[model samples]
Target: MIQTILLKQRPTGRPKISDFEFITEESDLTLKKDEMLLETVYVSVDPYLRGRMSDAKSYVDPFKINKPIYSGSIAKVIASKHNKFNEGDYVSGMLDWKTKQISNGNGLIKVDATKAPLSAYLGVLGMTGLTAYLGLTEIGQPKTGETLVVSGAAGAVGSIVGQIGKILGLNVIGIAGTDEKVNMITSEFGFDHGINYNSSTNMNAAIKKVATSGVDIYFDNVGGPISDAVLFNINKFARMIICGAISVYNNTELPQSVSVQPFLIKNSALMQGFIISNFSEKFPEAINQLATWLADGKLTYTETIVEGFENIPKAFIDLFDGKNKGKMIVRI
Candidate 1:
């Protein structure tokens, strides 16, 4: 039998286990010409998937009720009838949350387990890395010696952003929710400084103290008051890469924060929000660079791997509670 997870209903504020339904059916294990059987190996659970759970229009269509919920996943080809793929090959792409499934090999790409771990393709060497590199270089336009601050600095994308900033000669400061995350960003990821937002009573003052020269670039992942605090210390011509707003993703009503208009006016700053798909043309370049950095030991990544296919929804929900550091992956 094959097990699959479906969207039982659109979530009401934060997502709950009740919003997801698990179904099991007899396995077919059959494939037509130009098709292959894929057994899911790794599943990526991201905060942005929360946005898709809502019915509102956005960059991507919402997840339909009672339909399989898909995200970036790595799967192994156990059997194949396709000429382009062979049995025992592994591939990475957006895939359904099923224990096994069949595909015609359209968007999927073959991945080498020897080059990097299968899970890394869903993280540092994949979309998470691309978002960090393109969003920082293309949008942030970081220069050497300038200060770069990253919100959610310990996360999948933000962690890579901070490391790339350091590699590019920027003074990097990271903001995380816990003391341990703060320590990990600095001690493990080579960030120059780290701040625990949960412990800081005066975020504005804290930011101003550490970022004494003002922030030249801001990589925002969790946006809300933390981003508002960053506004007080931006340099003239500062660039803000508005990535995932995990902080407000589950808000029941409109989220309010300090006005950014005045900050931009006074600083002549630039704030741009982007979806990684918009920069698909530059993906090859981004992936090559990220791989180079990893091979040179200039880059590293972390993953919190959950052990069961049945726990995928819970692992995703844990993202909102900051339960995982770096990428959250379900290894089945």
Candidate 2:
């Protein structure tokens, strides 16, 4: 039998397990020309999926009700009638949440398990890494000796962004929720400084204390009070890369924050929202550089892998609660 997860309903705010439905069906191993059968191995659950669950106008269309929900996943080709794919080949792409499925090979790309772990293709060697690298270099335009501040510093992209900042010779400061995360960013990821936002009453003061010269580049992952705090400490010509806003993703009403216009105007700073797909042309270059870094021990990543296909929805919902340390993946 093959099991699959479907969007049971549009979530009101934070997603619930009831919002998803699981169904089981007999396996269909038959494959047509140019089609292949894939057994799901790993699934990537990210905060951005929350935006897709909503019917609101956005970069991507909302996941249809009672339909299979899709995400970045790694799968093995068990049967293939396609010329490009073969049995035993592992591929990665945006795939449905199913134990087994058939594909016509539209967007799937073969990944070598020997080069790196299969789960990594969905993370550091995949979209997550591309996002961090492109969003930083293209928007940040970082210069050596400048101060770089990262919100959600212990997260998948933020962790990579901070490491990349250090690689570029910039002074890196990370802002995380817990003391352990604060310690991990500095101890494991090589960030120059780490601030536990939950322990710090005044984010502005905390950021200012570590970033004494002011923030030259701000990689914002959580856009709420933390972002508001960064606004006050930006240097002249500072570059602010607006990534995901996990802080306000679950809000039903429009959340309020400090107006950034005055800050940008006063400091002559640059702020831009970054979506990874916009920079598709540079993917090969970014992946090459990331792979080189990984092989050369210049880069490292973490993953919180949950077992079982049934736990997919719960794993995704956990992202809101900050349960995972780095990239969250589900292993089947």
Candidate 3:
């Protein structure tokens, strides 16, 4: 029997651990011509999961009732019924949140832990990694000596974005929800400056103080009032990349949309929002660069790991509440 976590119903507010049920399932060796049984090691819980909860039009489908929830997970092929993944091979792919998963070997890809940590394949070196790379590279387009601002600055994707901006010769100012988060971002993630949104008496003043002149590139993760504050300091021709809005993820009603349209008109700013899935063609390049950086110590990642199958929903809830430091994951 394998322990698994399954979605029960659409949640209206904060998702408790009980929102997801931990149950046992029978395992079978029955295989198609090409298949494998994978043992999950780490499962990523992201803000994107909240979007999947609503029965709204989006990139992915809503989680069906009674179905096991699946997300990007790092796993090892324990028993192979397929030629693609042999037994004992490490891989990272979308897998059910459980002890073991049976797959037909389609989207699964081999993970090279000799180059980076296995858990990294679920975070900085995975889909979230790709999203950070693509959104910044394609939209942010920071130049030398330019000022860059990253919201949710201590997160899996935001931290990487800020690090990359520093590498590209930009002064990176990050906005996080807490003081500890601010400390980690500047001390650990190589950001030039960091602001704690929660403590800022006047957020606009705090942003203008750290960013000095103005923000040249904005990599936004937690949008809302924080974004509005940054939007007030945008430099001419500034670029903003909207990836995930962790701030509004748990809101029952539509969030109050701020009129930043004026910033675009005033600064000639280019603000483009993107879903990571749109960059499929660029995954290989992203993975290689992220892996190289990880091995070279130029990139670092932190994960808030919750052990056991039943805690998946709580891990997700923590993400929106900013209770997590970096990538939020469930260890199975």
Candidate 4:
């Protein structure tokens, strides 16, 4: 039997576990020539899944109702009819929320479990890592001695961004939702400063206090009021990378806020939004560099794992609650 989670209803605000329905069925796992049957090991629960739940237009297509939701999943080949994949080989791809699947090896990347942990392919050595690398280097164009401010600093992408900032000799300031996460960013991730956005009444002042010289690059993960605050501190020719907007992902409308275009124009700052796929052609280069850094111990990461496949939806919901320290993954 294969267990799968179906999106039972479109959510209004923060999603509830009730919005998801789990079902089990006798999956006749079969493979034709050039195909492989996979058994899921780790399921990734990311913030972007929230956008997919809505029927509205976005970078990725909305997940269909009554069908299994799909994201990055690390699986082991239980049976293979393909020459490229052998039984017991590990692979990662955009597989379903179900426990089992069949694929023709397209879009599936063979993972060397010996090089890194299986879950790393879904995180640090995977899309999240690529997102941080591409956004920071290619877009942010960070330079030594400049200030880099990253919101959702303790998250999957932001945490890595901070560490990479330090490696590049930038003054890295991270903004997280909780005190514990604030401490983790500063004490563990080598960030220059950490601000607890939840505790601070004056977010703009808090950002200014740490970033005395002004922000040279801003890696925005959670948009909304936090982003509004960061805009007040951009340096001339600064770059702002719009990564994720978890803060307003559930909003029914595009909430209005104070205009930031004036600040951008006055400072000649650039703000650009990107889907990780924009740099797909260069993924191998970034992935290899990230791996080298991880191997050399220059980079560090954390994962919050939920123990069961049935807990995938709960793990995803926890992201908005700011319950995770780094990447959130579900171990199947």
TM per model?
Answer: 0.98, 0.98, 0.95, 0.98
Error of 2 at 251 (Å): 0.4
TM-score of model number 1: 0.98
Candidate 2 residue-wise lDDT, 1-332, digit = tens: 99999999989899999999999999767888999999999999999999889874653778989999999999999999999999999999999999999999999999999999999999889999999999999999999999999999899999999999999999999999999999999999999999999999999999999999999999999999999999999999999999989999999898999999999999999999999989999999999999999999999998999999999999999999889888999999
- Model 2 misses residue 74 by how many Å? 0.4
Clashing pairs in 3: none
- Per-residue CA lDDT of model 4 for 1-332, tens digit only, reads 88889999888888999999999999768778899898999999999999999975653689988989999999999999999999999998899898888889889989999999999999999999999999999999988999999999999999999999999999999999888999999999999999999899999999999999999999999999999999999999999999999999988887777698899899999999978988899899999999999999999999998899989999999999888879999999
| Residue pairs with backbone atoms closer than 3 Å in model 2 (clashes) | none
Clashes of each: 0, 0, 0, 0
User: What shift in Å separates residue 152 of candidate 1 from its native position after superposition?
Assistant: 0.5
Every model: Cα RMSD to truth: 0.9, 1.0, 1.6, 1.0
User: In terms of TM-score, how similar is model 4 to the real structure?
Assistant: 0.98
The lDDT, on a scale of 0 to 1, for candidate 2 is 0.94
The better candidate by lDDT, 1 or 3, is 1
Ordered from best to worst lDDT, the candidate numbers read 1, 2, 4, 3
Per-residue lDDT tens digits for candidate 1, residues 280-325, read: 9999988999999999999999999999999999999999999999
Task: Please give the distance, in angstroms, between residue 50's alpha carbon in candidate 3 and its true position after superposition.
Answer: 0.8
Model 1 global lDDT (CA atoms, 0 to 1): 0.95
lDDT, residue 102, candidate 1 = 96
